[model samples]
Target: MNTTEIFLIAMLIIFSLPWLVWRVFNTDYFAPLVVVQIIMGILLGPGVLGKWSPEYYQFVFTPAVVQSLNGIAWWAVMLFVMIAGVELDLAQAWKHRRESGITAGLALGSPLLLGCGAALVLLQFPGWMGPLAQHWQFVLGIGMACAVTALPILILLMEKLEILRHPLGQRILRYASLDDIAIWGVLALILMDWSRIGKQVVFLIAFVLLGWGFRRLMAWLQERDRWYVALIWLAACGFGADWAGLHYMVGAFLAGAIMDAHWFDQDRLDQLRHHVLLVMMPVFFLSTGLRTNWAVGGAEVFAAAALLLFVSVAGKLIGVRIAGRVLGWGPGEASVIGWLLQTKALIMIIFANILLDKQVITSETFTALLLMAVASTMLTVPVVAPRMSAHR
Candidate 1:
């Protein structure tokens, strides 16, 4: 078959397998279609399907087909990240400054500290740290991964629970929004290249000026024109960030972060996100899965993943519990909020992917982190649903 046929075949498999599993197994309550797709990606990767059927894997995922898929995944993820950036309602977060700041700080810092400890333990073993990473870089990267809250996924889950517009849900969004900014800021710090500092500095300055002008332009344009302009901005920012050695995903986030979400229709924005996930993100997941390696041993990877998950969940709960005490939240509020804040699906995966791309963490570590993200996200709805219902 030609490359086109092979790529289509790959896409068909990517889209179909996850849906079949979600429907046939009725995993929606626990494992959403996105979660199933992520697992499916890993299963179809070299560690599982490729190992069992190297010939088939190679034939289906040829170099040309892989490249094609990667292109789609890149744009897909960029758009998704941009949406995440635009969704950041920092204004509301600031309006609830004391509450949001206290919760966001502890929520992020506690996991970071615990995750750093976990990273320290992993460092004792070989095959965990990436080649290009300094000891500090690897440690900090993993720690931050554990601390990350998937704001986009959190929003989705909140909407599903019918609390998206509720006061409690709005408060959760504020906390997550604050943490989201910190997460990206720390990522920029981690990705800083001393050798390319000049370029990065220049990029930042240029980004500010361009952002101001772009925002002005966006305000002037009709909503329909804004969508096209946003894509153009996305491409430009992505290229500039990649050129500055900070990664295009960071650029994508910045591109949307500076823009006002209210400029576009909320329903359209939500639909765009959903369509991206439906059509493009599965390919990204498959590509992500293709990178998973268990050379360090599957048992070790699972163990590490479990350790990360434990610290991630525990730290978030403990930190939020502290905040709850200080703020005098009603009983059960902290637990519910803590569990909801622990959702780490897409953003954590994206963060880990950047780490892997930068060689800040090895494939084994990536696999473990990926597993932790999946497990962490899966736990959110199951744990939080009952709490939310009871609290209501």
Candidate 2:
């Protein structure tokens, strides 16, 4: 078949198989459609499908076809990340700064320390660190990945639990918002290149000045006009960030972060997010799966994933529990909050993807991070549901 035929075939598998499995098996209670889609991405990746049927995998995922899909995936993820940025309730976080800081800090720091330790251990072995990575870069990158909370996925889970607007849910959102900012800040730090430092500095200054004008322009425009301008801004920021050597995704987040969520209709914004997930993000997931490799050996990769998962869960729970004590949270509150905060799927995956893209971590490490993210997210609802009910 031609490239177009092969690409369409690939898209067919990407969208259909995940939906069928999600519906047929009724996995929504424990594994939401998003979680199942992520798992399906893994199953469809080189590690599984390619291993089983090399020729079929290669035929369908030819370089040209993969390239075409990547273009879609890049834009899809950029839009998603930008939305995540716009949705960050930083104003609320600032309002609750003391509480938010304590929770967000411990929650992020503990996992980072533990994850760095794990990275240290992994450094002793081969096939984990990427060729371009410094020892410090590998350790810090993995450490931050462990500390990440997928704010977008967390919001989805909270909405599912019917607590998104509840007091406790709002509290959780505040904590996550602060951590979200820190996550990107650390990413910028890790991605900084001495050679390109000047360019990055220039980009930041220009962004600040242009972002001010952009925000003002957005505020004056009608809502309908704002949407088109926002897309144009996204494209520009993505290009500028890529040019600055900080990655286009960073630019995408900045594009949204600078814009006020109040400038658009909340319901429509939510609908846009839903539609993006429905239509485009599965392509991102498939492309992500396409990047997975088991060259380090399946057992080894699984071991690394298990290791990362343990630290991510343990550190999050430990840190949150500490915060609960300091804040005098009610009995069992920490457990509930901890479990909810431990949810990691999209954001952690995105962070690891950046690390993988920058060659700070090998594909083996990326595969492991992918597995850890899926497992971490899958545990959130099942583990927290009963605890939440007990309290109710």
Q: Considering every candidate listed, which one attains the maximal lDDT? A: 1
Count clashing residue pairs per candidate. Answer: 0, 0
lDDT of 1 by residue, 1-392 (tens): 89999889999999999999999999988888899999999999999999999999999999999999889999999999999999999999888899999999999999999999999999999999999999999989999999999999898888888999999999999999999999999999999999999999999999999999999999999999999999999999999999999999999999989999899999999999999988889999999999999999999999999999999999999999999999999999999999999899999999999999999999999999999999999998898889888998
Candidate 2 collision pairs: none
Candidate 1: regions farther than 4 A off = none
lDDT of 2 at 299: 96
* TM-score of each model, paired residue for residue: 0.99, 0.99
What does candidate 1 score in Cα RMSD to the true structure?
A: 0.6
What is the number of residue pairs that collide in model 2? 0
Q: Give lDDT: candidate 1, residue 238.
A: 100
- Model 2's alpha-carbon lDDT is 0.93
Candidate 1 residue 73 Cα shift, in angstroms, is 0.4
